[model samples]
Target: MTEILLIIPPFCYGDLSEAGPVYPSMGIVCVAATLEHAGYKVKIIDMFAEGYEESKLKSCLEDPELKIVGVSSVSATFKISLNILKYAKEKRPDTTTIIGGPHITILPDETMKETYIDYGVLGEGDNTAVELADLIIKNKGSPENIKGLCFRKDRTLIKTEKRQFIENLDELPFPAYHLLPMDKYRSYGVYDSGRKTTSMITSRGCPFKCIYCCSSELFGGRWRPMSAEKTIEFIKKLYDEYGIRHIYFQDDEFTVSHERAMKICDWIIDKKIGLTWECLTRVSHVDNELLSKMAKAGCKSILYGIETGYEEGLKQIKKGITLEQAKNAVRLTKKNGMIAKVSFILGFPWESKEEINKTIDFAIKLDADYSFFTILCPFPTTEVYEQIAKEGLFVPEFNMEMYSAMPAADSLIRTKYLTSEEIVQMMGHAYKRLYFRPKYLLKRMLSLRHFSELKRNFKAGLSVLRFTVKSMGKKAKLAKTT
Candidate 1:
């Protein structure tokens, strides 16, 4: 008989920047399902989709029966979450407010220090959230005993032991899509591939130990995937119910298991579900045969993190990929008639100017249908973060909010080898070099097979241009002040 509300805070980006359209937050959906299954009446307010202002958020929080309010956050949206929590307190001072997600998982103690948040649930929240809700309803549970949670006791922060990683991802129920406000979300494929889009995750966690990545710290070192049958069932339901033709597999690495991935693809083909999808993959996991099979099964595109062009720089970042593998992946994707998108990072601590140019050259050589470049960010809880901290290289004032808005260029934790300005310059150079080539422009123009593809590409290019100009202006203004 208890009522609960799950809120996803609004994200920034006044204008759609170079980054593509925003996807719905799946984490909240998962938590909502878990709570509902436990017999709690749950309502989800997705601010990103609904475009709610402070007044609207306050109205939702004003309910006297709202026993618990669960909010989700990431490093990019940490401040927004904090603001929502503060507003919740203003409306109902006694409400039990809980904060969970990536940011909280990494800095549980620091998050618990904020008086607005009653508890922080670290790691996967499906199980922990249900348990917390039950405890609040029964009035017999102590927050201190909850694993993967942090709370304050007698004005001191208390973090319980970390929760063990979920072993069988299949056990978690399908995300409560029915509970979400589906119409509020806009759907479009990444490259305008004529498919209305949705996002899915067949797996949790990544086994790779990339220094610049925080997935391992948050999801643990092991990879866990849902069974192929369960994965296909979700896809079938998505197609039949939502009329969703496009799916973005938001997995950290979708191709980690060869047999499992092939089996999933086989199921899709066998069922003739006709769903077009995209996913992030490692170069080493893919080859011509697998890519061909996936393309035949309705894979429109594949994104690979070819972090660097130079082998040494790749090694420096612990990307676990070779230049040959990256090149072959691109070639294979193209050969299989699928759009290949390669993502690159500029300004590793050990990278030199020559290495930066090599990365640019490599991206140009691959000539993937789409390419993305970002500056190296040493987010907290990663090996890169620890290394920068040990060497006194991290910007002391850097917090979650600043970390998110820090231009992909200026975001780099300043290294002993590369100045922040140098990194910013490299990011600009990488984009300009990869995108402005005459041959590349011609190829893109010729490859436009439909009006939607042309329009999406043009808009995406303009967004990148706007972002670059804005980033440059900010840099120039900062320099003048200094």
Candidate 2:
């Protein structure tokens, strides 16, 4: 029986994504680590990895010593998260229910209206989580003094002062990975080497203003990063303790600090940790020299968000990279013996069919080892979402279930010029043309070494075929209607 319980609600994508796309909830784990360092007992239940067994969940809720229940969620998964919190509130009305993450951080007032949620931590919850847990433990002190918190006062919503970002990330303890079901977590789609794999975040936030991105809102507009020494130490621990060979950095922009990245790579080489890693970053932040150093440090892959190929779409999104820059970045990544994984979006509300086609052609010309074609989703709290909502471009009764950029046929925001059906067809066509080529198939086959690699690749290939066939069927009906 612990004083606090941290829960991640199980979710289903409903044709949008795999039924259970499990990964460690780094947010909650970091909070748990803070609580542990502060001398508090904490328990975590990752419903996403554990399959959300009702009996097991009920057993966790039955702990008579439980004082606080914390739930973390993103924008799309907030509804499921709310439902789970509501259930917990019903079971133990006396226990305090707290919610945090991207959703609540973006719309604190709206989220606080949910009575089941007794409190919410606005952003970067490590410190605020400890504050809340301390309050519950002491059973004293008003929440009004706690910064970055939202709670009820006399049946009215009250928000506190904004919390400052942690300047030195080294001050925080390593994430409580021991509390997670490490064996059950897997992130496979488009991840070529997915055995004994886990994800890490070396830094937070981005300075660029890409309209479709919500990184700035979630991590604050400023870019704060952990020191190179701390990041390398964290990597060594993961490799030595968890036997994790492949690490995927989920930072908004890993290469934002070129000097820091270079130092980290050099340290990885000096220590000979023997772990291959991948990162996602803007094409503009990297150069040939950086790629060379990263390759020397066992960087096998680099994912670039080349959002669009057409200049007009690029301008609209403020991607800050020209077509030439993107091409050079991919070229450098491959030249340095790393796999270049590129991503593109098919539907911007202001984009035309001709422009979308040009973007698709550009992806083929780039000929990356892996490509992800997402239908542009105007997620809430994004520049694109605000623009689309103002222009009434979103589909009538648009639901969050289709908010995923994956699910080639799920289009919730359709431009006034193009119907939602057309966007879906275009997304499906992009994936089929990008992945089903003879050269692409041969390239992927040559890279395969183990059964796990073959299984993940085959599953991804089959997924592409299914999305294509479904969209093709929808296209015939759409053509008849026109």
Candidate 3:
């Protein structure tokens, strides 16, 4: 059997990572599950989980049995991911190197420019990874034959025919959680209690044409999900085998099909699978019945992307929801005893200061249990990124590091009406305004049910303060410069 190594490079997740919410990479873990099931010896190195020890990575690279080295990365971590593979090649020239994830999937040819990477897997890697590994390990077939793959051959980059999205998601193996450092995962302040918490994706893709999202491109703009039975089984496996007490569903819209979601909730209720969970979904996809069932079946939190406050900004972003719908969704979520966490993005290229302020005002007025205000990050492969690129909207200081959407981080692009610095300052102001309110603080304090909740709140609040102050300093500097 061929020994395969899959790596997730150390990437800063900004405030999220700073506030202690490290998670396993679902992409690589899924790939590992498929590869492991296919009889390959697979090892997963989560650099972030293990604290990025160069000596450990060096040791892994030295392993003679490691026939293939694979890495997964997003736009923010592409540079580090590339450097890792480059170093792997330098250390072990015999090992075949591959890279994949949103960044490489969007720009295959550009990623292949680094000769260190022998192949790039586009979109979902579960099936593609297995086929590629078999071909490489057995020297069985040409790289050109593999769909959803790109490679440099004879100094020419070749991307094969587009791979179809996996239709029956249930056929795919559950993510190989055993390969991950599961104990290292945490979800403090975001999920209840934080202990034994991990993230799962029950579905893939988004049907809505949200301009800032790349899910439609990556997952074929369809909502494909595992059967409710399979989903329950996976959840049970996590609870029983891994002792996972809390789960954060990383779905773009977990409640896309209310029927399926209701069935899932029913199973959790019937089986008494008592693990509390949280998920992200569109405002319109959820309603009173679903919220009621979700709360009963251990859904402690629900996060919604209310991208902007006003109607025009929402339309511009193709968010496909009205302010009234968002308000109703939040109201229902909280009414059903689940925490409603809403996120707003400021700094659209066409947005005026008043519009951005309106978004902040809306967030405060909506009064969800948690509110996150982020500056717009124009990720590649999204409609917003294309628009920004076409219009030369990116700021001079914009870089991949700012792609994490850290409120304090420099905005990547500027609107006609606002500079990047102004956008970031507004993000700071949004946080300070919403979080520092005596009403919000009193509500949070009253809602605390445990010491863990209090500790998590304190830590999270401290993180927000630090970021807010950092953002305010940038504003002061900008004022001086002007």
Residue range 271-333, candidate 2, lDDT tens digits: 887778888988889999999999999888888999898887889999988998889999999
Error of 1 at 144 (Å): 2.3
Clashing pairs for model 3 are 349-415
**Candidate 2 — which residues are off by over 4 angstroms?**
11-22, 187-195, 399-409, 475-482
On the 0 to 100 scale, the lDDT of residue 241 in model 2 is 92
> On residues 1-482, what C-alpha lDDT tens digit does candidate 3 reach at each position?
23898999887746545555677889888999999999899999998777788898888877778899999988778778888999989999999999999988877767888988899999988889989988988787878888999988899999998899889988988898998888887775545564598889888888888898888778899888888889988999999999999998998899999999999999888888677988999999988888999999999888899989999889999999999999999999989988898988888888867888889889988999888777777767788888888888898866554553433476788888777778787777788889999989998899888887788788888888887887876742433211
Clashes of each: 0, 0, 1
Clashes of 2: 0
List ranges where model 1 is wrong by over 4 Å: 13-18, 184-194, 399-401, 406-409, 472-482
Candidate 3 lDDT score at position 321: 95
How do the residues 1-482 of candidate 1 rate in per-residue lDDT, one tens digit apiece?
A: 33788888777553234346556799988899888888888888888777767776677776767889888998767887888888887788878899999888887766777898988999999889988987887775777777888888889888888888888888888788887766555433345355566688889998989998899888887789988888988888888888887788999889888888899899889888777788899999997789989998888788899988888888888888899999899999988988899988876666666777788888888888878887777778888778777887766776655754634536546656556666666666666667777888898889877787677768877766665665555442222110
Question: Which candidate do you rate higher for TM-score, 1 or 3?
Answer: 3
